[model samples]
Structure formats: C-alpha cells, structure tokens
Target chain A: MEEVVIQADKLTKKFGDFTAVDAITFQVRKGEIFGFLGANGAGKTTAMRMLCGLSVPTSGEAKVAGFDIYKETESIKKNIGYMSQKFSLYEDLTVVENIRFFGGIYGLTNEQIKNKTQQLIERLGLTSVQKQLVVDLPLGWKQKLSFSIAIIHQPKIVFLDEPTGGVDPLTRRQFWELIYEAAHNGITVFVTTHYMDEAEYCDRLSIMVDGRIKALDTPKNLKAEFEVESMDEVFYKLARQATRAE
Target chain B: MKAVIAENISKQYNGKPAVEKVSFEVDEGEIFGLIGPDGAGKTSIFRILTTLLLPDGGSAQVHHWDVVKDWRAIRNAVGYMPGKFSLYQDLTVEENLHFFATVFNTSIQENYHLIEEIYVQLEPFKNRRAGKLSGGMKQKLALCCALIHKPKVLFLDEPTTGVDPVSRREFWEMLKKLKQQNISIVVSTPYMDEASMCDRIASIQSGSILSIDTPQYLVKNYGNQLFKVKANDRYRLLEVLKSVPSTKSYAFGEYAHISVEKGHQMEASEIRQHLHQNGLTGVEIGDAEVTIEDCFINLLH
Candidate 1:
C-alpha cells in the first residue's frame, strides 16, 4: 500500500466572517501527482498557504509529511519544496549562482551544493548559459530552472502554483515531463493550474468551488461522473455553479 | 474594409528583435486573435497598432489612419487594454470609468451601450477600489474603461492569460457581443483552445507569424494523420514514440498525439505490436481530432 504523505480532516480557514477554505478533507499519497484546481478567489491560494505551513488553519486537523500543522510547522516546511509563478528564482543571478544559492538555503553542505549545482546545470542543459543572468533566459527556460531549484533539496513533496501559466504549449509539455520524472522518483507533486487540459495529467485531482471541494477523483472518473467528453466540459459544468462573484 | 493592417511592422529592444517583420490584417467587425505564448511579441504588435509605440521598421494603420503620422487619431479610434491592468488602482471602479470617458472627450453615457453588458456585472462593485476588487472583477472594470470611449477597434493584450475557465468563456461571449456592434477586436492569448472563439487567428512564435487562418481551416488543412496513443504509463509511452518512426509527437491532455507520416503504410496494429513488445500494456491507439494546438506545434517545426 502507498503511504499517505498528507492527510487533512475538516481543515478550515476564515478571514473575519468570510470562510476561505471551508472544511476541506483529503488525503494525498506519496509519489502522487495531486492537482488542486479552482477558479480565481476560490481559496486555492489560501488552502495552499495553510498546507505549506505559511498560514495557520483556523480549525480542524492536518498532517504534512507526518508533521502536525500547528506543532511541527517548521518541520513541515523543511520537508516540502514550493514554487509559484509569481515568485521563483532571482532574476539578477546567474544560472549556477541561483542553484548554489537555493542549495545553501535548503541547508545543503558545501559538497552537496557543489555537486547539486553541477548536476542541475547539466540536467537542465544550462551548461551553455550557466554564466548568463536568469533574466536573460527565455520564459520557458526560466520556469524549468525555477522548478529544478524548487526541488534542489529533494523534498518529499513540491507545491506548484500555476507553474506553467502563459508558457507556450510545447514548452509546457516539456515541463510536465520533468514533473513525471520527479513523481516517478517518489516525490509527491501538488499543483494548481488554470489549464483544463493539464487536469487530465494528474493521477487524482480535486476541484474547488466557493471554498469547497466540489469534486475529487481521477480525471477519467470525473469525466465519467460528469458525463462529459473532456475535462474542460467537466470544469465548466462545476465552476459555473459557483455563486461567488469572484 | 480592413479594420487594422500591418506591413512588416518590426520593433527591437536593445538590438534584439521583439517583433520581427510581423504582418496581419483585421477585417471590420471581426474577432481576430493573436494566439501565442508569453513573449511571442503579441503585446509589441498591439502597441504598434494602437499608436503607443513606434515600430523600428515597416508601418501599421488603424482604421486607415497611419500609426506614426496620425498617432492622435489612431489613439482616439482604438481602445487598448494593456496586458497589465493599467488603471487608477486607488480610484473606485466608477471613478476609473468616468476618468477614461473624460480623457477621450466623451461621457460614459454616450458610449454606455458599448460596455453595458460587462459593466452591469461590475455595478455592485462600482464603489470598490480597483485595487481591492477580485481578479475577475478587475478585468471587467478594465474592459469597461477601455470601451468607455467607443473606439472602432479594440486591442486586448493577453486579457485572459491567467483567467479561470468559466470566466474565460464569459469574456469571449462578451467579445462576441461587442463584435456584433461593429467593433473589431484584436485579442491576444496564450490559450490555444481559445483560438476557436475567434473568427480568425494568427499563430505566432518568437516574433514571427507561423500561420494566419480561421481555426477550422488550420485544423482541417493540418495535412497529417494524427493518432492519440495511450498506454499504462504516459511518460513511458511518450518516450517509446521516439522509436515509433513518427514525424513528431506532442503531449496533449491525457494522450500523446503522434503525427503519422503521410502515405506511410504502417498499420495501427504494427504500432501496437511494437509497443507491446516494448512492455507497454493496455495500449490504445485511435484517431484524434487536430486542434489549434496541434497546428501550432507542427508550425513550430
């Protein structure tokens, strides 16, 4: 049996009188590609924050990487990697410099950082542009590099927030290939994306609507349940039911 | 008559080409899309045609007015919602709309019909600050502000890039309604699926136009037999395609679409046999519909 890496029961967060995450309950196994999908203002960001130990849940219980949310938040942070489209690698740093910087931040030793920097640069095919500033690289290359750095410490899980937004179709698939490689190597991938086609790639995904988990299942199962031919149809059918203006 | 035209419009930044000899035309009252990924020069083309930036070479015209010589006229005739939400963030939604109307030497009531449908959605949040509104609401407010002047042509740069699927559908419906009122729209987006919503689309890449045609025409004329190949392991299936003697293969949703070589007599059974020998179980191969994304990737080659 696969090990459960993340378990949440009635996890809820509130801001004043408004509930951002309304008692979401789910379980994610190790080496699973778990998709956390929702619309804008659907509380995806807020829920992700709570799970990453950046924001405290207002109620309920949760454990990430076998660490309690409230008591072992620090340990949880160390056990997970995170990358968001809005924030990634430093723009002004060179390719090698950014990798070295992140490796050190993740508490890697001098030798580990050195070996990681070499392996990453070669793996990403950044050897030719290793000395170039990150800002000088193309958008696709920058995103791929940022993802590589996010898992530089080989965390058990990685959280990606719209990691492929605005990227070209071909390049986006290439990024997903990297994701598959990581999952195959026993890393859990929890990602949020607006792309409907990408939803089909996940082993199991949960769709959020108005701060609630409206549907949770594999893509094929969800489509069969919704009586739709494509994931896009399933998403439209679910998200259109949202009464919230956002 | 053409609503907008570009004759090899080019723009460069720091000796690097941002938009390279790009040329396209928008018919009056047509919804034309500049479909490409980020940094594909969509914004540069919009800026040039909207008279916000002068191209380094070639020329463009909006509503038959030269972009360079009649910059003021072009500005008055075009409504541009930049990729970034360029509004008075501190101002209330209502105030921003009124401000844009006054700047165009008109009143919101004069062009009320142009944005009535979209603004009605923003009515409840009219008093809310633009900065405090939600992402979808902010986009609506931006569209209302852009339409307050009743320009003949609208240039929306990546308006739906990060928008949700539902909101994206609504936004396109709004565009369809606006198009009916005789307003030409040139919208850019990174979503290949949205290509079908436009009357015509130009698949762009690295500052170059790959193809310009209606979505149907592009797909119908894709000129290759595409197959959706699926196996127990998706990534492994993708890797095995390298040995399948295909022209090109792309990962599309759940399946990897392989472009079967034209006139290649290899049957699907042979391909299945090869995969089964390669230890891929539960393999399925079927004819797949060609989408704009497939056309875009093929054009890239």
Candidate 2:
C-alpha cells in the first residue's frame, strides 16, 4: 500500500474578512504527482504556501512529509524542496557556482557538496558550460538546470509552481522526464499549473473553486465524473462555477 | 484583400536575433494567432507590424499602410494591447478609458457599441483604481482601451498569458463578438491549446515561422497513427515506447501520445499487447485526436 505523504484536514487560511482557503481537505500518496489547480486568486496559492510551511494557517491540521505544519515548520522546510514561477537561481552565477551555493545553503559538507556538484554537472551534460553564467544559457536549459538544482539535496517532496510556463515543447518534455525520475526515486511531486494539458499529467488532481476543493480525483476519474474529453473542458466547466470575487 | 502581409521580415537586437525571416498573412476580419512560447519573437513580430519597432530588414503592410513609411497611418488604423498591462494605475478605470478615447480624438459614447459588452463587466468597477483591479478586470479594461479608437486591425500580444482559465475564456468570447464587427485580429499566445480557437495560426519557434495554417488543416495533416497510451507504470511505459522502432512519443497530460513512423503498420491492440508483453499492467489505449499542441511539438523537431 502507498503511504500517505501529505495529509490536510480542513486546512484553512483567513485574511481579516476573507477566507482564502476555507475548510479544504485532501491527501496525496507517496511518490504520486498531485496537481493542485484553480483560477488565479482562487486560494490555491494560499493553500500551497501553508503546505510549504511558508505561511501560517488560520485553522487546520496538516502534515507534509510526516512533519506537522504548525509545530515542525522548520523540519517541514528542510524535508521539502520548492521551485516557483519566480526562479530561485542566481542569473549572474555560473551553473557550477549556483549548484555549489545551493548545496552550501542546504548544509552539505565541503566533500559532499563537491561530489554532488560534480555528479550533477556530469549527469545533466553541463560539463561544457558549467562555468558559463546562467543568463547566457537558453531558457530551456536554464529551467532544466533550475529544476536539477532545486532537488540537489534530495528532499522528500518537491513542489513545482507552474514550472513549464513559457517553455517550449522539447524543453517541457525534458523537464517532465526529470520529474518522473525524481518521483521514481521516491520523491513526491506537488505541482500547480494553468496549462490544462499539464493538469492531465498528474496522477490525481484537486480543482479548487471559491476556496474549496470542488473536485479531487485522478485525471481519468475526474474526466469520467465530469463527462469531459479533455482536462481543458473539465477545467472550463468547473472554473465557470466560481462565485468568488477577488 | 489581406488584413496583414509580411515579406522576409527580420529583426535583431545588439547582434542577437529576435525574429528571423518570418512571414505570414492574415485575412480581413479573421481571428489569426501567432502561437509560440516566450521569447520566440511573437512580440517582436507584433511590435514591428504595429509600427512600434522598426524592422532591421524586410517590409510589411497592415491595412495597405507601409509599416515603415506609413507609420502614422498604421498606428491610427490599429488597436494594440501589449502583453503587459500598460495603463494608468493611479487613475480610475473610467478615467483610463476616457484618456485613451481622447487620445484618439473620439469619445466613449461615439464608439460605445464597439466595447459595450466588455465594458459592462467593468462598469461597476469603473470608479476603482485600475492598478487595484483584479487580473480579469484589468484584462477587460485593457481590451476596452484598445478598442476605444475603433481601429481596423487589433494586435494583441500574449493577452491571456497569466489570466485564469475562466477569464481567458471570457476574453476569447469578447474577441469573437469583436470579430462580428469585421475587425481583423492578430493575437499571440504561449498556450498551444488556444491556437485551435483562432481561425488560423502560425506556429513559431526560435525566431522563425514553423508553419502557418488553419488549426484544423495543421492537425488534419498530422498524418500519422496517433494513440494515447496510459499504464499504471508511466515511467516504464515511456521507456518501452522510446525503445520501440520508429515510434515517436511525448508526454501529453495524463498519458503519453505516441505515433509510429510510415510503413511501420500497427494497431492500438498491437500496441496494447506490446505493453502487456513488456510487463506494464493496467494498460489503457485509445485513438487520440490530433491537437495543435501535437502539431507544434512535431514542428519543434
């Protein structure tokens, strides 16, 4: 049986009069690609921040990678790796330098960081331009490098927030391979994206509408339940039901 | 007459290529799309055609006005909504609309019919600060400002990039209504799925035109045995599919889209048996319809 990796019970967040995430509950299994989807300002971001332990929830019980969100935020932060729309790499630094910097921040010793950096440079075929500045690389290579650097320390779960936006097809294809590799290596992948086709890639998905989990199931089951041919149609049908105004 | 025409258009910045010898035509009163990912020169093409940027080489015409020589005429005859929200953030929504109308020497009431449907959604928030408006409202307001001048051609650059799905649909609906008024549309988007919504599209990559045809034609001519295959073990399935001779596959949503090469005749059941033989279980296979994304992915090769 697959172990439950992420469990949230009535996870809620409130900002004064606004309930951004209202009594939402869901569970993600180990090594599964769980997609969290919603329209902009539909509380998906708020919910993700809480799960990442970056924001305090107003009221709820949650555990990420077996760590409590409220009492063990530091552990949660340490156990999970994150990447988002705003890239976390330093553009001015070389590929090797960025890897070393991230490794150092993750508390790896000098020998461990050196070995990991060497392995990454070799594994991703970046040996030729490992010393080149990140900004000089093409967008696709830069994104691939960013994702590799994101999981360099091998966190229990990796969170990707719209990682493929604006990337070309070939690069997106390569990126997903890396995701599959990471998931295959026993890391849970929690992601959010606007691309409907991307939503279909997830093992299961939870569509949020007006701060609630309107639909949560595997892509196949969701399509079957919604009687839709594609994730785009399913999302359209659900997003149109939004009664919240931001 | 063609709404837009370009011949060997090229642009460069500081010794770097932005758009190469790219060319396409848009029919009058048609929804034409320039589809590509970010930095693929969609904006550069739009900027050059809109007379906002001077192309380093080649020539283009919009509404019979030379983009270079008849810059003023081109500007006067086109309504442009830049990818970014370029509006007065401090002013109320109504003030912004009024300002754009005055710049074109027109009044809101004069061209009221052109933007009435989109404007009604923004009416309640007319007094709100443009900067403070939600993304969907801000998008609608930008469209309103662009149409206030009643231009002959509308140029939109990635107008729906970050907007939510619901609002994106609404925006497209608005565009369809505007089309009824016989205004030519030249819009760009990073989303390949949106390509099908346009009457025609030009799939672009690496500063070059990959293909230009109606989405239907592009997919219809995909010319292959396309199948969407899913299994409990996706990683293994992908590995097996890649090793199969003459098989091309890419991850599409929840499943893998695979197509075989010519003369390599096969069926879905054959592919199904192949997967079963390879030890991947819970197999599901179906004939998948070709989509703009599949065509774009193929073009990228």
The number of the candidate with the highest TM-score is 1
lDDT (Cα, tens digit) per residue for candidate 2, span B1-301: 8889998899999999999998888889999998877678888999999999999999999999899999999888899999888999999999999999999999999999988988887888789999988767888899999999999999998888767778888889989988898999999887776778999998888799888899999888988788999898888889888876777888888789997776677788888888989999999999988988888877776
Chain B fold agreement for model 2, TM-score: 0.94
Relative to the true structure, how large is the alpha-carbon lDDT of every model? 0.89, 0.88
Itemize residue pairs with steric clashes in candidate 2. Answer: A200-B253, A200-B254, A201-B253
DockQ of all predictions against the true structure, Cα-based: 0.77, 0.58
Q: Per-residue lDDT of A1-246 in model 1, one digit per residue for the tens?
A: 889999999999999998989999999999999999998989999999899999999998999999999999999989999998675789899999999889888999999999988888888889999999988888889989999999988999999999998877888888998999999899999999999889999999999999999999999999999998999999999988898766
Give residue A38's lDDT in candidate 2 (0 to 100): 91
Share of native interface contacts recovered by each model: 0.79, 0.59
Model 1: per-residue lDDT, tens digit, B124-199?
8888899988778888888898889888999999888778888888898999999999999999887887878899
True contacts kept of 1: 0.79
TM-score for each of the candidates: 0.97, 0.93
RMSD of 1: 1.4
Q: Report model 2's TM-score to 2 decimal places.
A: 0.93
